[model samples]
Target chain A: MKKNITPYLFAAPAFLVLGYFSILPMLQTAYYSTLEYSFFGPHRFIGAANYVRLFTDPHFWATLLNSLLFLSVTPVLMVVSLTLALSVRNLLRGARIVRLMLFLPVVTPVVIAGIVWRWIFTEETGLLNHLLSLASVGPVRWLTEFPTNLVSAMLVTVWRGMGYYMMLFLAGLALVPREVEEAGILDGATPLQQVWHVLLPLLRPTLLFVAVVSSSAAVKVFTEQYILIPGAPLDNKALVSFLYRHAFERFDFGYGSAAGMVLFGMTLLFSYTQVRLMDREQSS
Target chain B: MRKALSRIVIITASAAAVIPFLWLAATSVKGAEELFVYPPTFIPRTFQWENYTGVWNAIPFGLYLVNSLTVALLSVVFNLLLSSLAGFALARYRFRYRGLLFGAVLFSMMVPKEMLVIPLFTSVLRLHLADSLLGVVLPFAVEGMGIFLMRQAFLALPRDVEEAAVMDGAAPLRLWWSVMLPMVRPSLAALAIFTFIGSWGDFLWPMVVLKSQEHYTVQVGLSMMLGTFVDNYRYVAAGSLLALLPVALLFILMQRHFERGLLSGSGK
Candidate 1:
């Protein structure tokens, strides 16, 4: 029997790239977290000092809270996206165009969307304020203030994300057999009840997938905040934004890596659940 | 009543989703004086068509576009080449440690790039690739999502086709190149589009790795320019819209493949 070396040869380049780029860098992050290191400064051993500073810092907690606040959008996104999907499914006309319009934001680069939204959210002469004035509401400092800015950023995520998630739900809804809905109708279920019992139950797997994906994305939220708010202070930063600021902006590699490790742990948990969900999907 | 209500809901949602893009298009062509009006007009009285051309000169947008194109194209080429080879090996051959290797690929897929940025930056720096185009492209040249998609594509093919090729004395490489790859053309298209979008729209890594204006990709360059022109943002609007044009065009022309790529990419 010939021992075929073809497979190994074929697989070598990919493994090398992944090893150096993905696997090696992850392990290196863990090491960097332990050292008081920066690109320009000499590496000094700092046993848990960075972690101590991070834990003690109120700003760190603020960023963590900001991340949790970001996660709050996941539920809103699910409801809005699912509603859009279900509504479009029932539409008798222009469903394809409607879906296209909804999905446009998903493909548009976040920076571009951020540019437009920033203009809209400008305080005095901004479009949003002008619209508010029609209802006699004074200009709300959307991007300039703290919590409003965060909420405004969340609005962009929801607007940009719902379309993609809606597509996921649309795919899921397509898989559901027609008979199930018919049976719900025979049982005299209201339109709302039909969704509650028939559609949502079968779409649970997709709901779980969306939940994990959206939450993981929320945890790593960067572009929206970075684009909309620009250089937000420590208190207003998302966890990843905090890590970016420290690592790249401040050049505090040690502190930044420690912050990054925390974010890594969080996203790893979400990714683990996602992988499990996907494996279940594949096997089923 | 129900149908009307649903139509209203969808229309409102679509408008919310798309109006920003329309506003951007309108704002991009507006002259400096036309901006910041109290009742912001939806359409420019006279379209500043030069704004589109001006974006290329206001910054080194041509340089950024080239940088972005090089990174995206190189990424697609390498990702397709390496991932398909690896995927073919995983799907077609039974080899030692195949499961472990496949598992490694899946594991790599799950770990977000942002989480690894600190070390990724340092590693690229150590290898003397930082602030170079290769530095931006190399780390993401072959992604887990590509390999996984290709592997799934290959696995879906029937075994008899490959068996007949093997019986005819075709070399494994030749068999893969001629027989297997052509059958997976749709998957390849899907993977290529995904890779192009990901690489072209990538911001954080490019921003971190690239230091000079000469190396900045469109997103990074436009971001810097936006900061520079905060009060007067017409140029930035034009610049961002230009950056979005290729992708918007891609999405329009290849909607089917884009949707396919996106649904498959739901895992990541």
Candidate 2:
């Protein structure tokens, strides 16, 4: 009899907090998305008007495009991180130190990464342009120019993300059977061929995991936009930053929640896929 | 020859990886004069350790550190207790709605934080938790990842010990405390370290809830300082380095466990 009730007692505390805070807020976000809501009240119900505004609004469209563009950076990120992972994972000695060095960026706070990277691309005395000048190249307006502003921010994301994804890939590599790689060599495969033919297939699960996780982060990135170019003209607003500007800056709660809902939908799509893939992996 | 090439590639990759830190360490120690040279030297010619002192005094940086530590500690404690309790329930006892409850937990994990910020802040505002450490820590205290990690840990425990204790008339809670908790130390350590590391560096939620400089986390303080220290890049760099010091140390000390925790939680 006591056993029958004990589990509920144990789970109740966490569920209570989660219910009141996390899950409830998601419902509130959806509810507020349909209304002219604020700290004061949800004064009026305007069904899908906020959604209509988002579809028609040029700013919304631009940020939506930027969200897609931001996510596109993941492929580049994966390639670079994979390359680094492969290189260091097979090292005979001091692999730990190399992995530690690479992983440093991941552990560093995002805002600090943002500020430091922003400084690195600063026009006059920043590191990148300083290095460029010694090669007799003129200073590029990395933070000031149109596409460069967005590109520089994307570069920072790739930098911060590489080590973390490298760690994931290394974890995957550890699970791959050694005999398979040796067999690839015995079949007279080149190193690149061994990777392409043998190791890459085994790494599919990790690749999917990285892709999904990276996509969610990429679409929802805020710190880079906030720190690098806070009011970074309409051209480069990621969805979360755009939501933040409206909800916090302009106090357009309805519009912001509408935008937030879209972010939620995108996250759901990715996470649902990830869960499906992961559950499949577990079953297999 | 291939080994040599791979080593060079690995070395160069690591060097590139640490370039920001290299630049940060160099820039933070540069005197005001040497900072704007036409092409700056990679190394600081003169070490200006005062940047650290200067930045620390420029604001209530110490207060930020204290507040961040407080929030992180509260988050760690809450997560440990709540997650372990929930984990034990899900992994041990059979209950009606157990599946539904666990599904809710999984679904809650799927909700991107951006979706919750507005309503969450409004709740924080209503409860008067706004501008307090509790507000910053409350939402994250019941983390899905921690619960999931704890559940996995609990599930892996051998059943015989629990069954033996139960047959001896041990109460559920008693068996949990006496027979189960000791065996899951590694997972608890992993959960606590990850929670501490995450809570310590979190910015977005804290940014929304916190309005006062007095309650700012280090991440918030750094961003806020960026606004005030446009010309004082060296100072900002120093502040950035100082903020990352503990995080780096923690990672170095628990590098293996951190990797294990991450891989077990996600990499499997």
Candidate 3:
């Protein structure tokens, strides 16, 4: 190839767009986090006052806790999705139907999914309550209740996630060598032992991918909490929802920016650790 | 016996995964009286197609649909053209800061969207792009995954093609457009499907930016309708169905490319 500025010119558009929208906003967000921004008063530098408020605000702590609690769905999603992948691997029946049905939610708009779920949890006319009544159970408050609301939201997230991750695991499972599985049989390992010792080690990359993606999604979750539990009840609000209410609803830019920074830091830390773990897996 | 057990597990799991969508379909057509009935009919006795039209009449989903299509199509066009170009630059050429630029792209993927919402909104407001579809589209028009996928696609191609083109006096743009892009058809298709679906489903940014009801995307429209239709379960269900239908069908139609997007996105 001849030496020229062509490569630079080719790459210019994407870099410029990302620089304006992604890189610059991040810096502005960092700066906003330190200010006492007000709608009426002149804005002034507060030097971490917003973060300080975050430490003292129990609501902030609760939202952070709720966000972390949402991550409890990660392992469950991985195990269930992977198990489904493994189970369907040798199936001679219903494979196409099963695959289509499971993966459907991955493409559904989150807001739409959340809205449908909201009706499913309706106290008087909900599908769940009606089904529970078959066993003579009273209508259980799902979204209005505390831990149950959290659980319901997590269940939705997990349900929506399983098939997407199942595909990943299936992709990984396909890569495992047939000779390796046969060697397990030659070594007299049971099928369960073969899965535990051989298949899982080979599936590590997909499993890590599922874990990282699921956790990151769990933390950034907004539409579900926004639609399912409108107004973002303090007890059940995720971190992003809290940021929305403060920043957009309250017009409290500084506090929202502070919360946003905390959320961003946690996401970065979590993703960095995940990348490092995957790298370790590769190097080993 | 083991076969039977696995069948049972697979069936049960698929049902769990699919029942909500089934319920969504059912509720979309159920009459007002049947929605609250005991042991709710798994299938509606009366499939009230009117519910669809009712919600259609109630909300400006027509406008919302147009807005969504505009943003998603533009995002797709920009992503396909720009990401492939960027990918070619990184994969086929020796450029300054190429490694750094690629690293930046990878790093952008890790930064959660939650972190950037406030600042992006502030940026949008500052630029007077607030309340327009442009703000909604601006944040995501050039996807990181698109560039990454296109780069991977380009890297897999033989190097000789570009050299041959250059030897024939094909300019950089011509080499990328006429020679190189046609080779990565699969990736371009995958990126198009992925970006279109993502842009269509996007809620948070659009909800924040678009103050006017007319500018609301499908997701934003449905969310706002969700608040107003608290008592109108049928209408809400219809709205939800409307929000989901287009992209859901698109996914069904283009399942192959969408699946490829998923496969490449979950990098090994």
Give the Cα lDDT of each candidate: 0.87, 0.85, 0.83
What is the C-alpha DockQ of each candidate?
0.70, 0.72, 0.65
lDDT string for model 1 (B1-268, tens) is 7777787888789889888888898999999898988799888887998987888777788899899999999999999999999999999889988999989988987787887888888888889999999999999889887888888779879989999998999998999999999999988999988788878888899999999999999999988998787765888888888899888888888988878777765642
Q: What fraction of correct interface contacts does each candidate retain?
A: 0.69, 0.70, 0.68
Question: DockQ for model 1?
Answer: 0.70
* Candidate 1 wrong stretches, greater than 4 Å: none
The number of the candidate with the highest lDDT is 1
| List of clashing residue pairs for candidate 2 | none
TM of chain B vs. native, candidate 3: 0.95
Which scores better on lDDT, 1 or 3? 1
Candidate 3: segments with Cα more than 4 A from true spot: A1-3, A39-41, A136-138, A273-284
Best of the two (2, 3) by DockQ = 2
Task: Point out the higher-scoring one by DockQ: 1 or 2.
Answer: 2
TM-score of chain A of 1: 0.96
Q: Candidate 2's error at B168, in angstroms?
A: 3.0
Look at candidate 1 and give me any clashing residue pairs.
Answer: none
Residues B134-230, model 3: lDDT tens digits: 8888777786767878888898798788888889999889989999999999889988998898899888888889999988888888877777877
What is the lDDT for A112 in model 2? 85
